[model samples]
Target chain A: MPVIGGLHRTLKGKAALFILLLSVIGLGTLAAMFLRTQREMLAEFEAERMQIVEHFVVGTLKPVMLTGHADLMSGIMASLHSAPGVQSLAIVRTNGIEAFTDDATMKKVNDRLGENRFSRILKEPVQIVPAGDPMLKRAVESGKSDFVRRDVAGDGTVTSLMYPIANEEPCHACHGDDHKVRGVLVATFGLSASEAGTLQSMFWFSGIAFVLLLLTAALTYLFIVRIMAGRVSNIVDQVNRIVEEDRFDKRIVIDADDEVGQLAISFNHFISSVEIYRIEEGREKERLEQTVFERTRELREKNDFIESDLKLARRIQQNLMPEKFPTPPEADFHAAYLPCLHIGGDYYDVFEMPNRHVGVFMADASGHGSSAALLVSIVKAIVSTAGKDISSPSYVVQIINNTLAKLTPDDSFVTLFYGVINLANGKMSYSLAGHPPPMVYNRDSGELQYLQTNGSLVGVFDFDRFEDSEYIFQHGDRLLVFTDGLVEAMGEDGKMFGRERLAELFKDARYERPDAMTRHLLDSLASYTGGAALADDVTLLVVDYKKG
Target chain B: MKITMRVAGDVTILDMIGNMKSPADLEDFSGAVNAELDQNHLKLLLNFKDVGFVNSSGLGRLVLAAKKIGDKSGHLKVVNLAPDLDELFTFTRLKEKIGVFKAEDEALRSFQ
Candidate 1:
């Protein structure tokens, strides 16, 4: 179903509708008041016409009746009846007798005579009949002069005036003085043409006024729509354009100091503010981007410098380890070094000492990476210089521990295992400083022995003592010396590659050559740890004695 | 790892929970111990009953922590170690450097 909404949907439509409605209500009220006033004025004019008619009839009839001139009275009444708008004029007797009148009254009197010889013989005898008009009878009985009424009779209005003829002193000559009223002079006047003209004129005037009011309303509606709605709509369109295009630079142009102009001014202020914010935001974004770019460039340069420095440090640490071991005729030596990071703390070296003894050293600093590598470097310098002068392994370890304790920080320490094998006697004397014990595997007996010696962590205390334990290397005996990294390596199940597992591997790989056995140990470790990255540096040194 | 420290008499008891396995865990543990040392709380007792595991790096951190405490002339002790952890301490011979107790009260008394 379609709805008939009022004209308030659009600003222009609503304005025009309000204007038209107000004009119609105002004009309608004014027209109603005008019609009411015109009706009152017409009624007053009709009443005045009745008064004049009554005065004229009473003035003309009173003189004639007092003169006792019935003929002149009858002639005057007959002339009045024939005058314009006059219907009838007659003198009606109070005792049901009508005296005097025009042709219509004479005909009524003749009809009342009805062949009566005495009524015909009387010369100008007054004929009596019952009073028919109630107002005339009332006027005669009351002796009141002015009595009038109006009756509508088929397209005409008949105004009747009753003027009572009182019994004056002159009338006592012919009549008795006891009578209060003698007769009623009744005048019936028709107002068909004049009243019709007045009504017609009133209708024409009202129609013209209504048309003029409609014209005024229409003109007012157009003027209001043009002056107010059009400007307001233009402002609205400008605002919509600004919003739709996101062009905060645009503004509404208002020329008047009206409410709409104030609205446009506020809108322009808001748009200007938005435009300023947008520019500021753009500048902020650019500044942020520039700052990020500069920071990123600086970070890249620093990273490049640090990377090259670390590479150099790694090279130096690698050089600290022995590249070639001194192969004594009694022993064959092979080792594997796996550092978990770029540089590590585990180090091993094989060198010849005095008395044709082969010295083997393996050490692990506290942690991995550059700091640990640096600690190991200090240990390497001390050991390489001190090993030449000190023949006894225990004495050399004691000197290195004391030197490290003085030089290193309190939290930094190294666990070292140093051993020297005398080629002439097949006796290997070793010292352990908080390091994992070395394991010796006998190929002939199929037995494994761990060189377990109690020692405090080196570099932690200057007074810490390391005991030298001697092991006789039998023929076909294989010795494994390694850092704790090897045994402490963890598998996925959180279990370490413990000493038992390493001893088992040592026993199993006793028959292989030294190099092949080291490879076997590493492969076993890889399999145990599921080939994951080693958590620490693993350094293993295997020395196999074929003949001692 | 979560570490909480409380003072009992002259002893600062550090209650440790969770595994100290990753480098971050080791750093957190060492940092906490160092912070306690910085405050001159030398007599430290580490309660490890709730600690599930300690990797090789974590052990190295513990060694470094013990050394740091010792260097400051502070006494550090560990208590309530799990079975594997106890074996690790014995195997690594860290028990020689730091006292290991089976109970918190014993470790605290040892501090005195």
Candidate 2:
């Protein structure tokens, strides 16, 4: 469907409508042809009636009046009156009975001769007569002759003609009056229009027949089109559904040898092809899956060397942690880290400072594995130098950023939760830079609370300020620090093991020991993954404070 | 496959004269006989006289038609079936579904 000036009209729909309109035009043309033929027939009927009446008027009345004999009309009347074919005939005088010059009319001058039907019509304006009606006043006037109109008779329609009698030389002499005009002869022409009635009947019958034909054609068209459209549309719908849903479980049932049956037969062939395609598709899917499995097994076999390399690297990274925790005594040195992968970029070190405060520094470099480990190594070197007197973790992070800001690529950053706990007074200072804050597991309240002290990612801008926050650690409170890799591990359904799920997973956890707790949490995550491939590294650290 | 049938009053002789690969031919023959039987209320003597094979679709069609005949308060008797066809018919258990006879006369007599 296309919108043209906001009106949606398609060429195919317009073409179909045009075809239907052409059919209607053809039907209308048929009707017009029928009406035209009927009009010709009516005209022919009227002309034939007029011609017959003109024959009588010219052959009988005109000659009689030319002979100047009144007896001539009466003789012709006598012969034509008794004829059964002639319905009625009357000769009316222009003045009175004395004006009837015909001899046959003279014998019954006072008698009502052939005047019964003529005068019986109460409305004298339009009437039916065989030898014309008495209303043919033209027959009395200046010899005007004509057939009357085709009008309603007792049974059907009829026509009449007037045999006009003029006041000629002989008729004028008989009058012998000083006035020029004399009474004229009148001949009634009554033509029962049975032929025209029959013609009219044929016209109406044909019209009705055509109407019936049109109705039948329309009805049959509608019926056949309905059934055919239903069947075809049903097949089309089924085919569409089959294509959409990719199913070939049903077949069309058509028994006839019509086009629709042929279509169904072809459709069955199409369905057979579809069935073959679906089976082939199933086989293809299975083949592809087998190939993928084989390839995966091969890849995993080759990956053993890489895993060993990563394990070696992890041992090297772990060996770098503080050994005995007695560099500067009377301060707690505790940390925990859970890496998502066999290796990760989350590393922390707590060393005793000369000021009796433990220097705790945690860093999460960008990404995982060897690249992140390289950057973490750089950060570790910078921090190990700064850890001597720089107990404020935020300033330490700022100095690391000033050193590494030129090394990072575009959109590359990391987050860290760094804190130095003052074992003397239990005052801890920390800075967070876009990292999930350390979860303080309160043994007193049996709740986990996150401490918020914010800083930006290191290695971003050289002059950026890093805010430092300090708080006193409670004896029973446990702090937990983790990298995003732990919370961002994906499940089979594309959902990440987000912070909320991690919290829920840890809601009833009581490993009691830092190493066991960290190991348990990491093992629980690996189990939740169900041997699925990991896309990110996992790293966490847990810290439990005991009164010194 | 095409089917042939001849109706003689209360007895309708049906010939499954062609390959009934889909059982549709059998069903068509049976349905024709049953329609006549229902319309005329005649006892049906259906002669499976010529059917040589039947497929699942064909067998299904026949089963459904026979069930329809039974629902219409009528009995159908099948006869003149070849041994192979009879084996196929027995596979569908048409004898258990309706009534099967070995001879045409017996099938006709079952109409009583």
Cα-based lDDT for every prediction: 0.76, 0.61
Give the alpha carbon lDDT tens digit for every residue of A378-494 in model 2: 778877887565457787778777777777642244567778777777788887765656677666777777777466556654576787888777766767777666665667665
Off by over 4 Å in 2: A1-181, A191-269, A272-280, A287-314, A327-367, A374-548, B1-112
lDDT of 1 by residue, A201-292 (tens): 76658856785977776786687656765566677778778889988888899878988789889888988999999999999999999999
Compared with the true structure, what per-residue lDDT tens digits does model 1 show for residues B12-95? 888998988677798789889989887888888899989977754677678778777888899889999987688667755788
True lDDT of residue A504, candidate 2: 58
Q: DockQ: which candidate is best?
A: 1
Relative to the unseen true structure, what is the C-alpha lDDT of residue A12 in candidate 2, on a scale of 0 to 100? 30
- The count of backbone overlaps in candidate 1 is 4
